[model samples]
Target: MIRLDTGAITEIALLAAHCDDLAIGLGGTLLTLADSVPGLRVRALILTGAGTEREGEERAALESFCPGADLDVRVLDLPDGRTPVHWERAKEAVGELRRGGDPQVVFAPQRDDAHQDHRLLAELAPTEFRDHLILGYEILKWENDTPRPSLFHPLSEVVARRKAELLMKHYPSQRDHDWFDEESFLGLCRLRGVQCRARYAEAFLVEKATITFGGA
Candidate 1:
């Protein structure tokens, strides 16, 4: 079990099909980055929930999740769960994000995700971020779409607890849902932590990565 450093990650890109997806998938990772890397720049794109309460929730949650980071986020009006129907618009949006900047890493959903919206974005993101490190994060929903992620971001017990707390506090709109509970969020971290031999951790599916040993 070798430990690796997330070297000089000054900027990152986050892609999600809907609001809260990024937070649910890697909220703890965001927190860890914000704490370790001061002034981290983050650019995020969500295909749905523009001009709605869900969008508002996302903005606030990200701010809290990535405290002290320069964050730019966009939530589009594309209809949720029907991403394939609006393929052109989604593709253009992703291209626009690529034009914005080149991030050191990209976070996205799994290409084989059960949810069509997640899957579509997962498939499309690589087209734009071809040479970047892209880590696929998983959303724990009703669908049996749990990913067998090879990469694990180890999280402290405190950070893990805060992720669950912010999730409950910021997204009041999602409170009605059964899965929107502290237990479910922390439980996933606990389960993944066991795999990585940590107190708590967040898992990521890595499609590709280039190792530069000894600083290349």
Candidate 2:
């Protein structure tokens, strides 16, 4: 398989319906980019979990994942499991985020995600970031919602373990959840790793992509 570089990108935007979603979905990717790209700018907007311990955990987790990078995060106060009910506010928030800056890539939840919150954000990402690469990420949960992703960002074994470590260390509030453990995180990464022939990888689904093929 050929490794495709995103080319000299300096900014990226991330959208998640909840905290920990980004960490669970693309922490390794963040870790990789932050380490390789000097002064990378990462902007994140999460629809829920504001004013709670989850928000604090999210800030810390992202900071840990994206060392040596410019990181900004905003968490909105919205009801969990009811993103569809607050469609207008959610859409507006996404729009506002778009107005803030133009990122080369946008990471959001997958449309086919079994969770409504995840699915809603996934659907909304393309509407707002039309000109960018919208990488829809998967979150593992009790529901059989794991997607057959077309994109795989390979992670080194160490980075994959570091992602698991950071997830467990930062989000203690999610510790009780049955699916929120290092083993499960590594398990999924391992599966994706087999597919990509790497020790580990994070998978994503691409709803749409634009490519240019000519060299001047």
Each candidate's root-mean-square deviation in Å?
Answer: 0.9, 1.1
lDDT string, candidate 2, 70-147, tens digits: 898999999999989999999999999999988988999998999999889988888888888899998988998788
Report the lDDT of model 2 for residue 164: 98
Report the Cα lDDT for residue 187, model 1: 99
Cα lDDT computed for each candidate against the true fold:
0.93, 0.92
Clashing pairs in 2: none
- lDDT, model 1, position 121: 92
Best-fitting candidate, scored by TM-score: 1
**Residue 49 Cα positional deviation in candidate 1, in Å, after optimal superposition:** 0.2
Can you tell me which runs of candidate 2 are displaced by over 4 Å?
214-216
Clashes of 1: 0
Task: Please provide, for model 1 over 96-202, each residue's C-alpha lDDT reduced to its tens digit, 9 standing for 90 to 100.
Answer: 99989989999999887899999999999999889999999999888877989899998999999999999999999989998889999999999999999998999
Candidate 2 residue 183 C-alpha distance from true site, Å: 0.5
